[model samples]
Target: MRENTEVVVVGGGYAGVMAADRLTQRDDVTVTLINPRPAFVHRVRLHQMVAGTHTAVVGYQEVLAEGVRLVTDTVTRIDAGGRAVELASGGAVRYDYLVYAVGSGSADPQVPGAAEFAYPIAGLEEAQRLLPVLAAASASAPVTVVGAGPTGIETAAELAEQGRRVTLVCGGVLGPYLHRRGRRSVAGRLAALRVTVLEGAEAKVTAVTRDAVRLADGRELPSAVTIWTAGFGVPDLARRSGLSTDALGRLLTDETLTSVDDDRVVAAGDSAAPSGLPLRMSCQMAMPLGARAADTVLSRLAGERPEPLNQSFGAQCLSLGRGSGVFQFGNRSDVAVWFHVAGRLGAKMKETVCKGIVKHLADEAQKPGGYSLHRMKGGAGRREALEAVRAEAPAIERIS
Candidate 1:
């Protein structure tokens, strides 16, 4: 292995940050992380921020590991032959190893009038812009949610709690991801909050004016505010460069997270769809996937074949309201495990999950070589005790 290896990771989300941080631990590799924004948007907290529950605009420099170079720019092109990343600012970045962690976003944008009128709860910028719009609008204003997925349900419940007349228009089965009882439980919660759940409503939102949603059903709902949270499509860079991509533009990867076209390039987070086991785009997947990507890269550098990714996680955590939530335990394949939780306990658990994410990033910085879990300083710079181990201990295996 050369000491001057240059690794450029594209994407500032969880996967990119974790890969860059882990790589920087080794003195030999020069890591450059490129993204469009300087701040790592904590998407899980967007809904809370929109509801005025929390406010901590996390900056990249704060979470990024020391000695790692960060470049803020959108990647426009990828020249694999030359190993050069063409940036939007008419510049180029070369890489010995490339980690494609650019995640997914709102899948379809061509929905008629949806972009112009509907608000999305994806990231900080959108949520910040949406807060004032909701606060100033009438408390009794009719709010129509376009999906009944996890995000749509959470948003609808939150809005309903805020005393807005919420009507959730689900095109198909409502809460199909949840168990039958779990689904009905959530429906009951929505009803308690005065949220009208409309299932099997084929709502082709033809036009979304400032006042209402013009549906193809000829039933014009007086939706003073429309929230569209459905259909997330991965970034198009994989297919744009002619790399083998799925129908949704997700780069087809092997079980080891290696791109099908090029073994040297690894894809993670939402942009990756390993052929055998496809993982969804959520905090649950992104967190572990980032660590797995790090493990694969580091193992390859250490002359060891990384284990195939068999990480199975489908526990969908959804925040219902300020102090209410539903914890649906699902098997690896997204089948519910027959246990659930609601109310304050569920909310506390969700809060702990958010805090743990931040803690993991902080823990990564204090560990040497980012190879294994060693004794590291906790939050507030508190020293942690370490256990003595052999020099040839396995610290970087099965990153979990």
Candidate 2:
């Protein structure tokens, strides 16, 4: 009997789940998905979880394909030469093809006392931990949310809508990704909610204390609770496994999502850096990348040429509490355009997007090849740009 082509996918985020489910399209392949948690985490709803508005979890039974084997465990190391992965439980699983999709976490602030005093809600557990803390706090307690990105903005709005006194410390321009009009809309909504928005160099948080946050401008704000959504950081598994990775430890891959070090390995989602240029760490790109990664593996298995990735973005959706939102439209290249939708219409659009995300995943699980996305026509240009960079850097050529 001919043995099945074994594919082991690490991580259970949007990308990993999509990749694993899509790989089930091939009858000759067996897919195994390894993750620490049994439930799928809707990271976008973590702020809702923190605010007691919604639970941020769903079961894999609803999202994962029937053929994909689910393993509730953690991967400690990847042995490329031996084609095996060492599990924390003292065993190893060999694979013919490996998908590296371990996603991101809250970045360490590296500020004095920040780690000990501040709360991070990047993951499910972190959000769960913050829920009770918020519930126990006084109604008028001063709450500070660090960072002005989507996570920070959503967190502050959710809490403020619940009658908490919320302060948003932007540390820089508010909504750096938003266009002027979009930013104005967001600021207006925030102001209407009675939430204070602080920006510029002076708003940059330098340190966190037990009951206050000190800023670079030498101003201290009384923060009964400090929520840090400043930035995200991926796991160091790729770097530790001796794989070629970017400075942030994302596994480096070609446009086809194949790892630079070994053709048998592929990467997807936030953990993947393709041709040294990674997309923003968001689910907006994860599912498509995951499907693309699976296609690359299927092509290799069938001895066919794989196509390069052609990625594009259309909008950046932000939920400002339950009844309000901002859907800032963007060009194909992900640059924010002047057009946007705000108020209840934007909120409905945001709600549709959140539901559509899960629906896409579920649909992919049922019909892998049916899923499709907008493709950019800049593949050759990207390769040329990478070549130019390699010529100047020399060492980059080896990875390219």
Candidate 3:
């Protein structure tokens, strides 16, 4: 290894920040975090920000490690051969190792007039833009939230709590990840809040206008404000840089989180596809992935073997406005079970989850590799995922 090993982490979200902070554990290593924004965005609270209930931002000082340097700029391209990254700020950063954590954003609406008329709540800028529009509009104007994912559900509930006429156009079953009972709890809350929940394929949105949204069933609803939280897509920097990526443009990595193309490159968060089975795009997965990514690099540097990913979800937290929620429990494999916590207790759990996310990051920032969580042991599911990946391509062996 060189006298001073330089590690560059691209992106300042949950994954990047955690990875960068943890990399600071080593005395001989230097960590530089490159991001477009100066502040850390608490993405889970973005819905509340749109509803004018939260700020959705935290200072890097509160979360970033003391030794880690922050660069407020975007990475335009990755020069894998040269082991350097080209930045939008008109310079290149050379690194011995790179952590690709540039996260996901709002996917293209792809519907007629939807792109032009519909407001999205995926990122900070989009939320900021929608805030002014919502403020200027009439209090009783009809508001439509497209997509029934966690983001859409929270946004619809928040607006309805604020006394807006909210309509949720679910493209399919509401909360596809939730159990039937949990789904019922959410539906009950929405009903209590007077927010209309339209489910099934017929409720899928077809297009949007300045004044309304058209459904797949040829029905149109008056929507003075249409908020699209349909789905997320990762930044294409990985694909554009000639790295091996999944169908969705996520960088392909082994179970250890090291890039298949180069051992010196790693991936985490929404932009990583490990063993052909990418984790769900949630904060619940990002922090663990980030820690694993750091471990891979540290192990390689120390000439030690790195452990494969042993990941599993425990529960899904859904906030209904600021007063109600559902803590839908899941098994080791992340499939929802019959049990759940509803109402204020659930809301408190959801709040704890949100606060815990930031606290976990800050803890890792201070103590580096001090974070730990109980993960499921490898089983048939992991074997099947690896078998599928090997069936298509050669297995990527760990370098060290």
Best by lDDT: 3
Give candidate 1's TM-score. Answer: 0.87
lDDT at position 18, candidate 2: 91
TM-score of each predicted structure versus truth? 0.87, 0.96, 0.97
Could you tell me which residue pairs clash in candidate 3? none
Comparing candidate 1 with candidate 3, which one achieves the higher lDDT?
Answer: 3
lDDT of 2 by residue, 1-400 (tens): 5568999999999999999988998888999999999999999999889998889898898899999999999999999999999999889999999999999999989999899999999999898888788888999999999999999999999889989999999999999999999999999999999999999998999999999999999999999999999999999999999999999999998888888899989999999998888888999989889988988898888778877788767899999999999999987667799999999999999999999988988998888767777244533445556678778774332212
lDDT by candidate, in order shown: 0.74, 0.90, 0.91
Predicted structure 3, TM vs. truth: 0.97
The candidate, 2 or 3, that scores higher on lDDT is 3
Q: Which ten residues in a row are the worst by lDDT in model 2?
A: 391-400
A best-first ranking of the candidates according to their TM-score comes to 3, 2, 1
Model 3 whole-model lDDT (C-alpha atoms)? 0.91
Top candidate, metric TM-score: 3
Error of 1 at 173 (Å): 2.5
Candidate 3 Cα misplacement greater than 4 A, ranges:
374-380, 388-394, 397-399
1 against 3, candidate with superior TM-score = 3
